[model samples]
Target: MIEFHLDGRSGVAPYMQLIQQVRQALRLGLLREGDRLPTIKDVVAKVAINPNTVLKAYRELEYEGLVTARPGVGTFVARTLNEEAGAVEPLRVELRAWLRRAQAAGLDPESIEALFATTFRIQLQESA
Candidate 1:
């Protein structure tokens, strides 16, 4: 029941929002190995987004080695987190850049916290 939230007005694309949330979950140790993700239809319904958006996000995740998709089955978090730890540095750099941009745009800590809270609830619902 993992629920996802995307800012329709954000300059970021919906699919990119999905991807960033997954990566953020990984970084924060929220999602672990073998966690099952909702099906594309479920994600679309839950997020109130297009099915293609969910599919695109899932496909990108799979490409990044974050999850695996099986035909007739479902997408599962990959057990490669340990192996991928070395790759987190790049993500850290990207996050720093994003933080700088957010700050420059006048998004204070409270605003960022609020955004995270709302999105986290959505994620929890989707993953549940």
Candidate 2:
């Protein structure tokens, strides 16, 4: 089960944030195939979000072939994005250290995110 959180200041739509969180969880191996997602009612209770919003997010995920919804049951992961779950912890530890160093160097969260996004895009382009 995944716990949902909202960042109101993120400038992203709540539903898209939910979808992104699910995708991230899949990538991190936190949600594996056949894992039941939290119920829409559960998400509404936890996040105070509208049920329709949760539905839209789940529908989008279903359309992406990442998950499936069972009527009267719950949504479930259909597949996973984590091909190398074993590699995650080491990379995450390195990322945490890098984040700490970035903070110590006076980079705020937004700045660090911007820097990382830019670098990530550049890396993708270069690799491609």
Candidate 3:
């Protein structure tokens, strides 16, 4: 199962956090095509957050063409690679901003690498 954690004091909204995590997973080549995600209820239970939050995140992911959800069946990651490659320039800017903030917060490269590794493993297991 994919494990999701929340920082109660984080300035980011729960849905935003979920969206960012999924995006990071995609960018880092963690989740791949045909990878299914947990149901909204399951995500709620795992993250200890409201189901609406998960739904919101899923909606945003859908908007980005990163995932698709069908009634009865759960949401699945998009099978297409480079689906968002056209937006790479903007994404690069965003990544740079995020990296600056992380660096300012004293999160070194090793810690960032570890975070990516852990998230990737969970996503792989969930997809498997």
| Best of the candidates, TM-score | 2
How far is 124's C-alpha from truth in model 3 (Å)? 33
Give per-residue lDDT, candidate 3, residue 53.
Answer: 91
lDDT of each: 0.84, 0.95, 0.83
Candidate 2 local lDDT, 47-117, one digit each (tens): 99999999999999999999998999889999998768789889999999999999999999999999999
Could you estimate the TM-score for every candidate? 0.62, 0.70, 0.61
**Model 1 agreement with the true structure over 1-128: per-residue lDDT tens digits:** 35688898899999999988887777667778888888888877777888988899999999988999988899998953455777878988997897788889899999977876898899999999
Q: Rank the candidate models, highest TM-score first.
A: 2, 1, 3
Local distance difference test, candidate 1 = 0.84
After superposing candidate 3, which stretches have Cα over 4 Å from the reference?
79-128
Q: Identify the runs in model 1 with alpha carbons over 4 angstroms from their true place.
A: 80-128
Give lDDT tens digits, candidate 3, residues 1-128: 25577887999998998888777777667777888878898888777899989999999989988899988988999754556777987988998897788888899999977876898899999999
lDDT of residue 61 for candidate 1 = 96
Separately for all candidates shown, the number of backbone clashes (residues 3 or more apart, or on different chains) is 8, 0, 0
Error of 3 at 123 (Å): 32
